[model samples]
Target: MTGADDRGIEHGLPADGPSPSALARERRENAADVLASTLETRDATAFVHAGRGREPSIRYCCESMPHGRTAVAYDGTTDEWLVRSADASDGHPAADLAATLADRGPEGTILTPPHVPHDAALYLENAGFEVASTEAIARARATKTTGECDRIAVAQRAASAGIRRAASVLADAAIVDGRLAVEDGNGDTVPLTPARLRIAIDEAIVGAGAFPAGNTAVNPETVSHPDTDADREALRPDESIVLAATPRGPSGYYGGLVRTLVVDSDGGRERRVHVAVTQSFRSARSLLTAGSASVHTVAADLEAEVRSFGLDDSDEVEATVSGVGLESCEGPIDGSDEIEPGAVVRLDVAARVDETSRLRIADVVVVTDEGERPDRLAAPAHSLSPAALLER
Candidate 1:
């Protein structure tokens, strides 16, 4: 239950260490080494398609992994890679990849992701390449190298700092000043009204050099918009706001943080909601050091903790926590899955006390093996004590 201030450090990252770009490069190199050694003994290749359209790059196989690609590639003999384009004039990045491989002229070429799509796997099949499946790809990506662990550590630190900034922002505002407010994407004013502290919390994330990647304000009257825009515009005060901030560090790699904030009127219902949510948050954090729990275990404990408080009439609302990393909602965590080291998971806890208010808490953390347990992260757990909240 100790707050970040009580810990006497800022998000627990090594800010003065090597530059993020350097760290990222080292991580990539380390991952490549692992892949090469493994693949040389086995038989496989990495196929990558990354970034958005127009800027996207695609490659079927590589001797070493692509510089910025988080995925790793295994070793192949011949030293030559190939490039075969369905349409040469199109100038696709995949074509370039084919060219790179052909230039190397490996002993034998494999067709990976042969059905990927235009500029993705289209040219691969035309060039006599074969395909790999979803499960095979997942297993390859799941294993992390030593360098990746180091970079992930740094990323977790960055995300934790961003979350702290968001929490700090909400902590600083007061309802006395005619409702200090911030504008949403639609330009609608979300009042920083007392009990509706999420408005301030959202603004805090923005102040920390990040964007709100997702939003959910579900209430009893939760404006169910058959249309998406209207539902986004009218979030009731009682609603829960699940906000995600993905910040791009100097190295161009992303670190993510997600938190839940809600506003509720002052009353017994509000108190209950706060207690339930606070308890759930505590239960999830307990998993961070216990090491006995998997990512799924963390989610299960949260549900059990909330249920023990008897807040919800039914357990219809399932998981509030998920795997978070380069992407905000990384998966395979909220179910019967395990969380590996260097995985960053964000826990979202929400409880509706009554019709007018709700309580939500989001905490960012990294899954580590540093403690006596399997999961550890640099970020602190979400805890709201009267003294902690009231303090500067």
Candidate 2:
């Protein structure tokens, strides 16, 4: 099921004179060589420490150079890392970069980073270098190493602390005229806005030694507008609230968590939506295991469970199962790659309850070889009542 190009390091010139396909393959290889060399030079002094204080001097295969005009390249065959710096003494950085690469043998085809700036990519192509995507390098990083998992766990703890702090704020809030308000240290009742809640969550995350990398959404359930900005809304009594956080640890690994809370309510439609999402989340989590399932199969099972509750389809629900590590969302479950052991992933389920409100629940899970339930990172209770969250 793999092609010649897919066979890494196997591609080579044909026995006969190079055909167009063979020439293209050669170009790709040359490009890879250049990129690898560049990455080495950029990370020359880099060392990634593993868990338990073990340092493994590992280098990344692709990295952007600190200088804007030039990129680095690594030729695997020669084992040489070369830096192509722009001769900008004359003040033409782009032109200098182009000339530098042009003089270094055939430009062949160049592989660019996924998020490369458009101008940069265009410049390479204009300089006779065919531009290609570097997704393979990204896909290779989907499975987490032992050290990466440890980093992710640290971020998850920070994310949990943030959510818990926000929950505490909600629990002690007083409902005045249906709007939730909190008394300040001076005992003055102040209306709780979405911004205030977000501040509390962000502060908690930073206090726990993590960066608030993702948006903090504190949405009130009573608002019927789907696009209602959370920052502009006020928390209301007897309604559900959604709290979601993604915090990045010191190692730059991310952890995500989302939970729904309800004030003293009769547990009406909100409860039903919460139950459905929780079930779908569990179903999706169960499907993530090493070598047992693909992203597509997991997504299918999750969508099916959501539909069984008579909720909207996957499109409307925004159901997501994605790898979480360096990036908040990476290697979507629907990707062609199969789940691998040590892959940390997040299962996020959100369904609209009405025009004004939606219910969402998410948790990070780790794929293990044992085939048991994946390790849940954010182990806090999924749903909490106002009184329960208020408890010290």
* Top candidate (lDDT): 2
Model 2 per-residue lDDT at 14: 21
TM-scores, all candidates, are 0.61, 0.69
> How much lDDT does candidate 1 score?
0.44
Task: Write one digit per residue (lDDT tens) for candidate 2, span 233-302.
Answer: 6777766688888876654567899887876767766777777788887777666642457777776777
What's the residue-level lDDT of 196 in candidate 2?
81
Query: Poorest 10 consecutive residues of model 1 by lDDT?
Result: 1-10
Every candidate's lDDT: 0.44, 0.62
Judge candidate 1 at residue 135 and give its lDDT: 31
| Alpha carbon lDDT at 112, candidate 2 | 50
CA deviation > 4 Å runs, candidate 1: 1-17, 37-42, 45-75, 78-90, 99-115, 134-267, 288-294, 312-317, 331-336, 370-387, 390-392
Q: Which lDDT value does model 1 have at 4?
A: 23
